[model samples]
Target: MKIDIVSVFPEYFDVLNLSLFGKAQAKGLIEVHAHNLRDWTHDVHHSVDDTPVGGGAGMVMKPAVWAECLDELLGLEPADATPDAAVDTATDTAAGKPVLIFPNPSAPLFTQRDATELSHADHLLFGCGRYEGYDARIPAYYRAQGVNVREYSIGDYVLNGGEVATSVMLEAITRLIPGFMGNPESIVEESYTGEGALLEHRQYTKPAQWRGLNVPDVLLSGDHGKVDRFRRDEALTRTNDIRPDLIEQLGCKALDKADRKTLMALGWEVSGEHPRRRGK
Candidate 1:
């Protein structure tokens, strides 16, 4: 996959040159490039931001600068472009399209599910916004021209810019690419990959006993069936104690006879909203 990022501080992307991302790029599993947003400016200072047009506290990234950068890099002609529109023919494509992503605090929360989908895209273009954000017209204009564009947030809190968020997202997506991981089964067994979409169960290494504590007896029993059940139970217990919200999201769909029994033992209703179990 081809990944392109446009940011005011391209050097911020050096993080991509480390660890898995670096190895992936070197092995030709993915391509990553970071461009300076200021390169599209014509001014002597090459500024990319300007005071808000109306009344606003922070400056907004200029659409003109972004327009040039995007049009030149992705070869997108604005919906309103004239016959003489400045279009880059070398990098442009009719069938080759890119998904445009803008990271914002108000956007839909990014999840492993999103990472799974993005890992398959042919091209991904990220616009790392700063200050207040890019001009609202940037995404609107791209969508009007038939481009696939989306805004996503890593979480509810705020960040200085989308640069760090981009790195976080890139890592999640790139690591999912086929053959990227040494053990593919690790992906399937991860916390949110399947039925147990909750926190992982406690893990134990060699020297089963430490101090006065010991590994769960079931784990050392050599019975795969019992071991799996014990792990699932532990996973459910941890989720209930820590993030019941995830269980709530899963709803009744994630429950079966065994799971319902576990919850009942913990003083939770099998299918009711109230904590106290309703007499079934």
Candidate 2:
């Protein structure tokens, strides 16, 4: 995979050379480049932002600067004469296409599922907006040109800039790429993964007893069947207790009789293929 990041603080991504991601790059599994967004500016100050047209509190990033940078990196002709048409249907087939991403605080939260989906793309271009955020027209114009443009927020909160969010998303997406991890199976049963998207079951290492707290006896037993059952139950219990929303998203088909009994005991009501929090 090829990743291009456009940020004012391109140095923030230098850490990518220090860990597992660095190893992946060394082995030629992924290629990454971070470019300064100001490099696309031609003025003496190389300014990339301006006061909002409607008089906003903070400066908004300039669309022209982003367009020039993106056009060059995405290998597309300038859209100067392009009409403001609806996004083309070709964007529906994103395989092998360059996906353009922007990190926005107000956008939908980025998810593990999105990471898994984007991991298949051959090239990824991330535009990290600063100040108030980029001109909305940037993404709209690119989409009109048939580009796969996406904007996401990492969480519910705001950030100083998109640099951190970009890093978080970059790691999430790249780690899912083939051969990125030393243990491929490590990601399989993680939280927010799998059909149920349940929070992962707790894990314990050797020295079963730690600081006077003992590991669950079931984990120590040689019976793999009992161990699996114990972990599944714990996972369901934890998810329901800590994140009932995940439980609500679970399909009835994903649960068997044993799972149903467990959830019912926890005050969940399963109706058809959807489970609800009882009264709701």
Candidate 3:
């Protein structure tokens, strides 16, 4: 997949060159490009923002620069296309038209589900807003022109800019693309992925016995069946304690007789009230 990120602090994206993403790029499994938002500016100051309309506390990004940049990137005619240009159904775009991405706290929370889904896109264009954010009309104008636009938020808290969130989201999205990782099965059991309804099981390394702490005995037993059972139990226990919300979302049916028994043993509330477990 190809992803283009437009941000005032393009340097913030330099970290994308590290580790797996770097390797993925080397292997041509994915492509990423960072563009400076200021390049669209025509004035000497290269200012991207001004006072927000309606008297806001923070500055709002200027619409003209955004429109010019996006128009050029999306293949809209520079002469005819402007932020205030009339919306139309024309589909012309540079190469594979990217699905536009805007991160906003007001938008739906981004999830592993969304990441997995976006990994399939042929191209993606991420708009990283600083200050107050991009002019509201930018996305609205694009959407009116038949562009596919999606908005997502990482969490409830706000940040100085969208670069960090975009970086995180890019990692999540890219790793899911086939061939991005050497081991195809590596992501199969990742938490929030398919069939991984519970939190990921705790991982361990060498030094079977460190100080007074010892690795789980089952892990050393080489008994694949027993090891699998142990891992499942740990995952279930962790999820039940740390994120019961995920368990609740899985609902009663997700807990079969074995899972219920494990939870019961862990002192979780799975007694007569949860009658469905009795038949499982």
Candidate 4:
């Protein structure tokens, strides 16, 4: 996979050269290029932001600068056009188009499912916004050119800029790419993955008893069947207590009789495939 990141602080991504990412690059599994957004500026100051057209507290990034950078990177001609309603944002990456992403605090939260989908892309271009944010028209104009543009927020809170959010998303998406991880299976049963999408159960290593806290007896047992059952139940219990929203999202087909019984014991009402908190 090829990844292009546009940020004012291109040095922030130098760390990508260390650890597993560095290893991936060494093996030729992926390629990364971080470009300074200011490189696209033509002025002496190389300014990339300006005061909002309407009164605003912070400066908004300039669209012209962003457009020039993106147009060159995405291999497109500059055109004045409205976003096409027929443009499919979900087009398959195999179609040989690069996926364009922007990090925005107000956008929908990025998810593991999104990472899985983007991992298959042949090329990805990420624009990291600073100050208030890039002009909204930047993404709109790219979409009009039939580019697969996406905007996402890593979490509910705000950040000073998109650099950190882009890093977080890049890590998530790149790690899922084939040959990126030493053990690919390590990602399969993780939280927010797979059909059930439940939080992962707690894990313990050797020396089962640590600091007077003993590992679960089931895990220590040699019986794999019992161990699997124990982990599944723990996952269900943890997800219910910590994030009941995940329980509510669970489909009936995903839960078996034993799972239903466990949820019922925890004051959850099972209606069809969905589970609800009691008295809610």
Q: Write the per-residue lDDT of candidate 4 for residues 159-274, one digit (tens) a residue.
A: 98898998899899999988989999999889999776999999999898889999989888899999988988899999988988888888877788889898999888887658
Q: Which ten residues in a row have the lowest lDDT in candidate 2?
A: 85-94
Task: State each candidate's clash count.
Answer: 0, 1, 0, 1
Candidate 1, 1-280: lDDT as tens digits: 8999999999999988988788889999999999999888999999888899888799999998999999887796655833333234223432367878899888999988788777777788999999988898887777666666778999989999999999889888888999777777877766766544877888898788999899888899999988888887888788788977666665665577777788778667756542343453
Q: What would the C-alpha RMSD of candidate 1 be, to one decimal place?
A: 5.3
User: Is candidate 1 or 2 superior in TM-score?
Assistant: 2
- The candidate scoring highest on TM-score is 4
lDDT of 3: 0.80
- Per-residue error for 136 in candidate 4, Å, reads 0.8
User: lDDT of each structure?
Assistant: 0.81, 0.89, 0.80, 0.89
* Residue pairs with backbone atoms closer than 3 Å in model 2 (clashes): 252-273
Give the per-residue Cα lDDT of candidate 1 at 119.
Answer: 78
Q: Which prediction has more favorable lDDT, 1 or 3?
A: 1
CA-only RMSD, every prediction: 5.3, 1.8, 4.8, 1.3
Better of 3 and 4 by lDDT: 4
Model 4 clashing-pair count: 1
lDDT of 2 by residue, 186-234 (tens): 9999999867799999999989988999999999999999998898899
| Residue range 1-280, candidate 3, lDDT tens digits | 8888999999988898899999999998888899999999989999999998899699988989988888888887544324444333223233345688888877889999888778877888899998988888887878766677777899999988899899989989898888888898988777877743778899988899999899988899999988888888888878878986675555555567777778777655554434222235
